[model samples]
Target: MQKKLVLGTAVAAVLAAGTFGAVSANASAPAAAPAAVVKADAGSDNLFRTNHLTIDAATDAAEAVLDAAEKENQRVSVAVVDRNGNTLVTLRGDGAGPQSYESAVKKAFTAVSWNAP
Candidate 1:
């Protein structure tokens, strides 16, 4: 019958289209670009910028520590250190002398080297 033939043709078209669609979908997508590998140059100890301060900044820190100690009525020596073990500033109270300076520097250096306060 004509109806059967038409139905057969319609079914065939649909099956053909489905097959095409499935094949296209399963096809591999374009390969992604390779990931970049950043290599660090040797002999450069700087992971980032260096940390250094001027004398004024160091003096200011000492002054602040001295003022805070005065307000708290505590006699102690204080030393501020850079990110490195280098001493930035140092302040000693009336009772603290040469020994206090050495002690404060040692404490600051220890803190810097250990990465702890």
Candidate 2:
């Protein structure tokens, strides 16, 4: 019985030592370096990048509409949106109702959706 107990203890100690050695080796191992990121140049052929409207152009369009409305003596709100339904400019004329703002936004979104002028 004494011999068997000694043999079992020796086996357990060997297994524990092996586990500790493996953990220590892993802890000392150097980590791999991160991959470098590549930047795209202006001449690069990137399919993800496409034409987009500039804020200046959108504001000009909204101003043109406001000019027309002013000439007609109309108190209204104007909203210019992009292809993605993002409002680039929103203008409310003098004495324009609060609901006119929401109406103008909806109109701009609808025009973008339908590709209307």
Candidate 3:
């Protein structure tokens, strides 16, 4: 189970890196015609759009992690954090160690800080 967890984490990290790399590569390309442009609200010029997971999406992500761990008979804690490293959702699975909760939050924060999985 531990091996599987480690392998899965590694795979996810690799995939995330690849995805970010692709995005960066495309960013340098010449801009194409806009598909659709929505005018921003007045006085919004100082603010740039940013994407973050919704509450329900974050909860679903945490639940998915818990479910995967449970399938491996592993007690674990799952946490989802926003781009700013704020906790969005946390789940301490049955029989999870007390320390697991904090650890999960820290891990989630680190992932967010690095913009990696």
Candidate 4:
């Protein structure tokens, strides 16, 4: 029993020492360097400029749709999206259906994606 206890204690000490050494070695190691940021050149062929509608222009377009719907005695929602299919303006006219908001946005996105009216 005594021999067994002594052998077990020695094994435990060895494992503990190995764990501590590994931890200390890792702690002393240098940290990884940060990644460098590369800026794209203004005239780079990989990057192209895209024109999108301004907020004022998008809002005006949405308002025009709403006005036309109102003149036709129709309650509706209007949405204006940019060339990237990003919704810029959404107008829910009076008494418009609850689902009209999402529908209008989808319609605008579809139009922008297809580049159609």
Taking every candidate in turn, the Cα RMSD to the unseen true structure, in Å, is 34.3, 33.3, 12.7, 30.9
**What would the TM-score be for candidate 4 when compared with the true structure?**
0.56
TM-score order of candidates, top first: 3, 2, 4, 1
TM-score of each: 0.51, 0.57, 0.60, 0.56
Where does candidate 2 stray beyond 4 Å? 1-49
Error of 1 at 63 (Å): 1.0
Instruction: Candidate 3: list runs displaced more than 4 Å.
Output: 1-39, 42-48
TM-score of 1: 0.51
After superposing candidate 1, which stretches have Cα over 4 Å from the reference? 1-49
Query: What does candidate 1's lDDT look like per residue over 1-117, in tens digits?
Result: 323322222222111111101111111111131112333555677534322444454454455455555565545566656556566556666765456566666755665566552
Residue-wise lDDT of candidate 3 within 33-73, one digit each (tens)?
11122345668876554344455555555555665566666
What does candidate 4's lDDT look like per residue over 9-116, in tens digits?
Answer: 222211111110111110110112111234467788786443334455445445555555566666666665544666666777788878777776665566556645
Cα-based lDDT for every prediction: 0.43, 0.46, 0.49, 0.46
How do the residues 20-73 of candidate 2 rate in per-residue lDDT, one tens digit apiece?
A: 011111011011211123346767687243344445544544555555556656
Over the full model, what C-alpha lDDT does candidate 2 score relative to the true structure? 0.46
- Clash counts for all predictions: 0, 0, 0, 0
Model 3's TM-score against the true structure: 0.60
